[model samples]
Target chain A: MGSSIAANQLVWHHDLTGQVLDPASLNLFWFELTEGAYGQIHRVKAIVEIVDGSAWQLSFNQGEDPMETELPVERWLSGRPDRPSQIEVVAGVDFDPIGVTAACRVAGSPMRYYSIIKPSCGSSHENRGYFLYSWQL
Target chain B: MKIAVISCIHGNYEALNAVLSDIDDHKVEQIYCLGDLVGYGPHPNAVVEMVRSLNIPTVQGCWDEDIIEGLNACECSYPSILAEQRGKLAHTWTDQEIHPETREFLAQLPMTLRVDNLAFVHGSPNNQHEYLLPEIDAFTAMERVLGTGADVLFCGHTHVPYVRDLSDGLVKVQVKRSGVSETATQIHVAPLKRIINAGSVGEPRHGRPNATYVIYDPESAEVKLREVEYDYPKTCAAIIDKGLPAIFAWRLARGLEYAERAEDPTHICER
Candidate 1:
């Protein structure tokens, strides 16, 4: 893959509950990881984004705790085109002391889940115009 | 021998699990997957891990190749600019989300796999991006299917499943041997050659939301298409929570086109 710039670090409130997101409205969002008894994160991954009034949902999990979220179309459009806007982070996030503390940064912390390599990295490597991160949520 | 084939599992782990459970109930000797272990859905890592752990023989699909060989535009027939953009976004996310080991597994996958007389590929035998639609011409279809030179060719790419049997006309074909002084020998063309598309296990576009797969019974020369329903609502909600495009979540229940969400107010996005 071609090397591109890293996504800017943005403060995000990971939503574990699937009900907070409204499918009617499109937006950018991400999910919270569910840990097994062994402290290993489960393989569930979720992301829902809305574009041109149509919402796109992508999640993969066969086991328990399949988390969901809703990124309202407005908030998805309000960011600096590179980051999600700070608004309704988590509607009813479970009480996790670590997550709660991590969510309290005054300035945005480094993005933990945004390590997507830019798409313009291979044979078609010259058209390096605005390499967007694939994760809209 | 009874063989099971699954393909185009674009990360909908629920569907994959359901299909696997269903496959377990049947008595099959060998199971083969026709690539595309990731892309589209959210659980690329899990899907890759499951297939790897099971030790299923798999051939790489176009999307799998893209994910492994540096993300690029997919060959899906998404019509609109918004759809194309969303598709690209999903691929990119999958590239980032996949485990390095999984990526390595996909990278080393062969474009086609053969066992005895059966051949497996993601698209056609020659090109991974080729779409062997059901309505293709007999001669054109024969050209690609014959490239494998196998008695039966099994592939998945168009997602919609079907079985196409092309019979080679009975004729006396002449063959010359380099070491022999005899004239060309005459032989009859073989029986009907078959192409079986196993369809998509994660996402189905055949106007039904059930997960799809195929079981080929060599003894009876039969291809059985199977569709099993899983927990789609959970998947839809996960997609939304993960912040992927909402339309993907909305379409799982109906197996309808992306634009169909607009016409029906009862769609998941509307609710």
Candidate 2:
């Protein structure tokens, strides 16, 4: 009810296509947004890790002319085969769901779907362990 | 009136009998069976026969649909290969052993039932295979109930019972389209809509062997989760005697889930 994320709460706000995630992006790391029992949201901090591929990248578009942002080292030494890149964090995606990109509003907005809070996820079944680059608010 | 809802009996006649008796004792005016009358238990025929004879209003569960339409499990239905194999063994057995009339009953059962302001389904309104877990995403959860157009939705399949309230909220979405004007959609969820899971009567996985069901009072909008102790050991024995996997019995005695995928809260069933 308040604007503060409660203890043990994780939240995510994303508005993209089919939901705009590239199949080549490998593991979107969903647990970062859906752990904890509180389901509240004060802030979001995350790190995107490149688990595989020489050209580790994050793409916003997927059509013919795509906007691809390549990680520095992962691209420089790409296709070496001997060097498989696995850069963690800003090198990848610290999932700031409510990042600067959104045409977004939280408290002041008349409607709020900013984050889908999963309030009943404290059980062992839902806990798939933290498998990411960053998860500190 | 006090209404009793039972789900996922899974062919355990003993647990079903006990829970039915408990419902009788509670003096419920109406009873609802949220399908899964067969599968992974000792007495599919007897269980189906009893429910049929009792004339309980039931909605088709995922297992119920599977017996009629063949196995249509979605992602994470079996967490591991061992679990999948075990699930298939049970499925094959249920498919072969299920009586034609019983299968027919399951086929005739509606995927959803609406009574006054309450709607009932074996899983989510979307599909019987979809799990309306207590921790399911708030947006998806609200959408499920809204789709039902009901004040409350009763569902089961997770084998663990719980309730969630979706009340007084704004659902905003900014849709991204290709070569078109950007549009935003909003739905105002007001008052309250509830999702009540009746848990499992036969193969409970909430860390106990007691059969669970739900008693809801439509007038007061109150819900009472009923866990009734039955002769589960007899059901366990019958599981082994009837040639079901022995692990099913072992897990039944402990109320541990056997081969059923009850984990993965974020999994939204594609089916």
Candidate 3:
């Protein structure tokens, strides 16, 4: 676990090595969640940029049009029978966790998170891993 | 007899709750599910337990099979890397989160269920992953579903709602978009063979964020395509909270397909 202060907000962080992401591999996802009314969980509204290693980023901004990419991520999200209104990020932030810090707004709000770091398909067998993380406000 | 058919729950408890409540309002005599009880969303165990307590007869979907058999990945047909990536996350999380009893229910689920002249399946009578799309040739579709010898076949996999009538020599098709009134689109089938894609209860792909199912009244010989609105924000939030893919939660509000496919503008019938 690690702690950093940003904009008078004490943000808590965790390195999922050997926990969510395989410690032996050089790939993993870093994500954050926010708590909502009535104890519902949501994604932390923040920008994620990879400073080191390879990172894959997918973002669903709150009140913003979903990005138009090869995949209709927004349309699919809207089409989900559950009808989630909050923004979410899945495996968007993919990178090696040795020196990565995700900038998230962690003041006064509670959130939960889970991520995975596994081997890519059609790739050679390697020491791949899965990882998870949760931060409650 | 009036039978309510639901499919492609994908583990969203809130959506299932709404759909089930709506079904109750309809006062259907029997309820059946077309498989895919878990996948994409959160609350796999909760959904499984509810279905079990209600004792809804269900068929096996590809995701259910993946969880029961401990498969590495779900049989989702997404061509995009991002969708594939998130799908992997959903499968992995759901595989771990499902209750053992849920596993048992999914494990013992039959691939197909026949009731008199109607057949229920997750995808098609032949394969759980096989899609019975609207553009499928009528004869080929007939051959695929004819194995059960049921004149009316109901299946769900594509998450889209459609009805195809292959009676006589003509192939009539009906695809319902979201917001279409339930009464306006009531299907009265003729003596010709028919196939109905019941759509998804947990995840809809018809560009609508409502939970969908089918109400087939044998007494009236009518099929009603019903879409009910649920607390999507609650379910979506639960998905992210459970550490599943955020995309899975985010996509539920839009009600559209995640993957892209080459559009075939022309509808051709194979002889």
lDDT of 2 by residue, B1-271 (tens): 8999999999999999999999999999999989898889979999999999989999998888888888654324644323545677798999889888988988999999999999999988888877888877888888888888898999999999998988884566567678878665665645788899999998899989999999999999889999999999899889889888765786788787665473564454444
At residue A40, give the lDDT of candidate 3. Answer: 24
**lDDT of all predictions:** 0.61, 0.66, 0.61
Residue B178 lDDT (model 2): 82
Tell me the spans in candidate 3 whose CA falls farther than 4 Å from its real position.
A1-137, B72-76, B169-191, B257-271
Docking class of 3: incorrect
Cα lDDT tens digits, model 3, B49-149, are: 99989999999998898787755431124332233445656778888887788899889999999998889998888777677888887666777656677
Strongest candidate by DockQ: 3
TM-score for chain B considered on its own, for each of the candidates: 0.85, 0.94, 0.85
Tens digit of per-residue lDDT, candidate 1, span B107-153: 99999998878899998887666677787777667666667878788
lDDT at position A113, candidate 3: 17
**Best lDDT goes to which candidate?**
2
lDDT of 2 at A51: 18
TM-score of chain B of 3: 0.85
- By DockQ, the better pick of 1 and 2 is 1
Question: Residues A61-98, candidate 2, lDDT per residue (tens digit)?
Answer: 11223133445654222211333322111111333433
